[model samples]
Target chain A: MGLIQRVIEAAGIATIGISIVREYAEQVQPPRTVFLKWPFGHPVGEPHNRAQQRAVVEESLRLLYEIDTPGTIVDLPFAWRRHDYSAWDQPAS
Target chain B: MGISRWKNQLLALLATRFPALAKKFTDSYTPRASTGDIPWVRPAVPLHRAKLALVTTAGIHHPEQQPFDMQDANGDPSYRAVDGDRLFDNFTITHDYYNHSDAGKDPNIIFPLDRLKELVAEGKLGSLAATHYSFMGHIDGQHIDTLIRKTAVEIAEKLRQDQVDIVLLTPG
Candidate 1:
């Protein structure tokens, strides 16, 4: 993802990323990033939680201009609502 | 630091130094990339006025196109273009590494096109590019090189052609 982000950036488009794992994001070092504690495959936020999802996306794009320097990661301390995770609770296929 | 912390650091250093200890680390580890000279071009327009594009490595594709190859031992490095304005309810996930239960429920959990459009409407953003992208994130080894060198460049061209000012990469 970072590789592609850099490619687009080099083409003169600014880029920002939302990362669930700090390790990978730190490795490639995108132009801007928002690190979230969301689970894998849920980078924006939970399904159906429109407000939280929209907020995460908004903040990530906000980082593109808000960041003064390249390769900056805005680590966001976000917590997933502790509901009975329906996905995990699903009957196994 | 505490004595226990010092011991753990020492062990980590030894693992990097000695093959014997490295083999016993018992987890995935990668040497970090040197990014001193990474390319970055800031938008001339503020994010609120710039056209936004969303890209994901979540192995999602429109139901019409072919799915990513889950059987490839080297992993699939291919990418698909998703029509941003089109209804994306039929989009599906095809990767093997990460669990897709939630994404399967609502792909906005991974792709978030709906949320992005809302942002655009609310004036929190400018506009959505006509095209967004999807690639399989589990690509590894030589396949990953192909992804970076070939597909990434190709997509960059598409984004450039679309006049995208900024992109949001959502990785699952």
Candidate 2:
């Protein structure tokens, strides 16, 4: 996934990836990423959890604009199935 | 299903249930290391004004499309062009490297197209690209080169042609 991100970014389009494995992101070094210590299949969040999914997408998109350094992986604070996503306010720009 | 597919499915299930086992599995496969400068592109527009697209390595495709090649141990590096507007009408997942039962129920967890649409409606996002891309995330060995040189580049060109300003990638 990080590999594809690199190719796309190299083509001049901004990219942000949601990575479940930090090690792979560290190795492939995609331009921007947000890491979640979640399970292998769930990158955004749990199934049917709209708020959680929205939070992940919002934070990731926000970082795409804010991250100036290449290969920066922001460790997301949301815990798998535990974080209170309903309270997640969209981060200030 | 072939024995390799069955084995991979079992491993995926086990890994999803056990984080320690998941770590071991990820540790077993080393992605190609970064050798040179990493690629970088700053966003050209704000969230509410940029055109967004999704690219996922989650093995999702239209049911009529060819399923990913699961018989190969190295994994398939090809991609599926997903129609963002009609994907939820019917879809299929062909990845054995991860248990996708939950994703099968609500693919928004991996693809999140529905959530993105909601964002567009609420004016938090600008719009979505008509076409998105999907690939199985288990590519390894020689297929990695094919992905980096061929398939990924093709998708990037397509995104460029579409005038996409930003992309959000997801994994499975």
Candidate 3:
């Protein structure tokens, strides 16, 4: 996924990736990434968790604009199945 | 399912349940270390005014589309172009490398098209590109070259032609 992100970014479009595996993101070093400590196949969040999903999307998009350093991977603060996403608000742009 | 496919599925389930086991699996597969300068680009527009697109490695596709090849030890480098408007109406996930039962129930966990739509409706985002791209994430061996050199490049061109201002990539 990071490799593909690199290609797309090199093509001149900004790219941000949601990575469940931090090692892969570190190795491939895509321009911008948000690392979630969730299980594989659930990078955004758990199934049907609307607030969780929206929060992840909002954070990634926010980082897309905020991350200026290349190869920056922001570790998201949500805990899997533990964090309360109901109060998760969109990050202020 | 073939023997290898079944084995992969079992492994995926175990990995999902055990983070330590997942780390071992990731440690086994070494992605190509990116050299030289890491690619960089700023968003052409702000989030609320930018045309966004999704590019995922979740192995999702329309049911009528051919499933990703599971026979190869090296994963498929091919991509499926998905229509954003109608994707959730009918879709299929073809990845053996992840336990997709959860994703199968609600693909928003991986693709999040519905969540993005809500953002658009709320004026939090500009709009979504009509088309999105999907690929299987477990590419290895010679297929990595194909992905970097051919398929990824092709998708980048397609995104450019679509006038996407930013891309959000998700993985399986």
- TM-scores, all models, native as reference: 0.82, 0.97, 0.97
Return the DockQ of model 3. Answer: 0.70
Tell how far residue A24 is off in model 2, in angstroms.
Answer: 0.3
Which tens-of-lDDT digit does each residue in B70-155 have in candidate 1? 66646688899988777375777776555676777878888988877776776767888988899877566788678778988899
lDDT for residue A19 in candidate 1, whole number 0-100: 81
lDDT, candidate 1, A1-93, per-residue tens: 776787788878888888877777688887888997666667877777766676677667667778878888888756666533333232212
TM-score of chain B of each: 0.79, 0.98, 0.97
Considering summed lDDT, which 10 consecutive residues are worst modelled in model 1 chain B?
A: B23-32
Error of 2 at B3 (Å): 0.9
Judge candidate 2 at residue A13 and give its lDDT: 99
Off by over 4 Å in 3: A89-93
lDDT of 3 by residue, B1-172 (tens): 7888899999999999887899877776888889999999889888999999999999999999999998898999999999999999999999999999999999999999999988898898999999999999889999999999999999999999999999999999
Cα error of candidate 2 at position A72, Å: 0.4
Q: Residue by residue across A1-93, what tens digits does model 3's lDDT show?
A: 999999999999999999988889999999999999889889988888888998899889989999989999999999977988877654433
TM-score of chain B of 3: 0.97
